[model samples]
Target: MGMFERTASVFDDAMVLDEEYQPDKIRERDEELEQYRQALQPIIDNRPLSNIFVYGKTGTGKTVATRYMIDHLQEDAEHYDDVALSITWVGCENLSSSYQVAVALVNELRSSDHQISTTGHSQQAVFNMLYTELDKIGGTVLIVLDEIDNIGSDDDILYGLPRARANGYIEDARPLVIGISNDFQFKENLSPKVRDTLCEAEILFPPYDATELNSILYPRAEKAFYDDVLADDVVPLCSAFAAQDTGSARQALRLLYLAGKRVADNGETNVTGDHVRGAKEELHQSKVIEGMQKLTTQGHAVLLTLASHTANSETPVRTRDLYDRYKTVTEKIDADTIVERRVRAHLSDLTMLGLVTVHERNEGLNAGRYHEYELSVQLDSVLEVLSEEQRFDDIVEIVKQQVHGMDRT
Candidate 1:
């Protein structure tokens, strides 16, 4: 390679191995892929495929593998004109309500040549319009609702599909549904009727074992980086750590990229084990910032206060003590001070977001239940994305001490 090309390669090499670089056709999951394929096999046979529920931890290839199967089914179903396949994939988070989902599905089904009103229609009318469209197409409809648990009215969407078939809305067309979620209790929360209809076929994607991750990542790494660029031990280390957490191929790829970037940033010629260690730290920081971004302003502020107080404190603070610190923080920003009840609510939000962890205790005698909360990720990591006033270099030292219990003067 020429000198300039080689120089560019350093950054490029890192990014090429990223999950963003992953192709839709390529995935490391074989068993899960086949199971999804079998689940949709009835749909291909022009029979009513049972509504499927796919459950797994996030980044475990559940979403990707499910999509992959749908793509293949779409391609393979071209032979039969009798088998008109219409698939609507919706991310439930973006469409939280049944009305919103109906609108989205209606808008998706309509052609640019044909104008369909997505607004000013009653929620029931929108669902009717959707059913009419499905009938107009006159074939089997497959709706894949990703993160279906995010839909505020999951039952409205889940139960609505099978019921559409039951009610003879689309008389000639059969509808099959696939619901995907990371929340384990999402199914339990569903109404009995919805659960019965949606769980006709259940597929659970377990975390990738180390062997599977290693096999899956090897080809991706080879395609992503220059030959012989990464040390012999780097890939295995990445695999081992990823398998331990969630066995997410996405996480493995991300870690690989982070490791390579760490090496390149340090002016190293090749990626090494130390690079992997740095990548783990960088990944931890990125996760914290992401968690902070998802919080409301009050939630973010609560976490920032926790970060600030924890920046110098020797131990995790009790919930009451943390609220005292939070009140002082609210005053500094000229924000209305929230009562302890509200502060408690925000703290729970923070814990759910994975920004902070709660330790519950039941003491002996009259001592009642209380919580001691601590940051899950380093304080410095969250400060970067939060308001600048909250950012501090001391946060880096604080995290180092908290995580490693190191004595840093």
Candidate 2:
């Protein structure tokens, strides 16, 4: 037998657990689906188009539910003789500004050969190009912007696209925006005019509870796994773990998938709670490492400072002390030092990333409250990642020395 010989596996249809897979029916989201269907009902009735804003946390079935409703809406609209519908979906996770998003949408609507460059166009020029493409498609055009919050506050496209017909940017196309976001603050921070124009029908998808996750996971497992492969406690354990963490159906499915993969890799037949727990830890560590790897150089410097203090058993240190140590680390590497306020910002970001924890200390009325920061992750993990960079070698050694000195003390 060859080294890469095939082996018997448990997965029957692993794609069922994939993030991009759209199930024929979306379970546990009937209420959201009904609201979504009504939001699109105007297009079927040949009435004026309505812009929709969808809000939810990650893995709450927002994108899948929207895709499901869009598929059904297109099928239903086929019955009407006068209704002509065109749909364009663009994921804005990587596109950070309105300009980038506009370029993305324009390319999405255009054919492969006619696609415009992502750069070199003015904001208005890109908007014009988008308007032209929409006009070419004509009729009711639905533009779905997924992860729309990545655009931040640069929302000119959101304001202009929804009112394109009224603004005479496009005569033939009645284009409406469908903005999907996981951030609730993005909606609140939108300019009133843009919010009013883009959010005619707002739909919210709440996170899935354990029961809902179970209802979703069982059918998927039935299709994804072979008979007798999953132990009785596998699905429930995965669901409960995900529910307690983020209430994400996607996370639950991912846990189950990873658990089965672990069993398959170990040449085992049954997946149990133990497998689920192991998979959860693997997933978590993978995420932490990935998050750490994506940090800016200054962010890594800030983390290394914290790690050094942690090694010295001196953590839960305030920003002032951290700044002094951080400046020392940056200087050792000949990197420019940022202001104390900016270091605080980096710490704030690290806290959000689950790499650091902060505690607010309240003093008497004479003294104002302050925050102390500490490494929330394993010190060795942070050091391992930071050690990958050659520039940080000197500082990594210093952190190791701190650990050794503490051991001797």
Q: What local distance difference test score does each model get?
A: 0.76, 0.91
What candidate 2 gets wrong by more than 4 Å, as runs, is 294-331, 335-376, 395-409
Q: In angstroms, how far off is 61's CA in candidate 1?
A: 1.4
Question: What TM-score against the true fold does each predicted structure earn?
Answer: 0.76, 0.84
Clashes of each: 0, 0
What global local distance difference test value does model 1 have? 0.76
Error of 2 at 186 (Å): 1.9
lDDT of 1 by residue, 325-364 (tens): 7787666665677789988988888887777888988786
- Candidate 1 wrongly placed segments (more than 4 Å): 1-7, 10-28, 80-82, 113-119, 292-332, 335-386, 389-409
Pick by TM-score: which candidate is best?
2
Ten contiguous residues minimizing lDDT sum, candidate 1: 391-400
Per-residue lDDT of candidate 2, residues 1-409 (tens digit): 7789767789988999898788888999888888898888889888877899999999999998988888888898899999999899999989999999999998898889999998788999999999999999999998999999998999988988988888888999888789999999998888999988788899999988999999999999999999988999999999999999999998999999999999989998888889999999999999999999999999999999899889988979988889999999899977889999999999999999999999998886966788999888988899999999999998898888888888897
Candidate 2: clashing pairs of residues: none
Estimate the Cα RMSD of every predicted model relative to the unseen true structure.
Answer: 5.9, 3.9
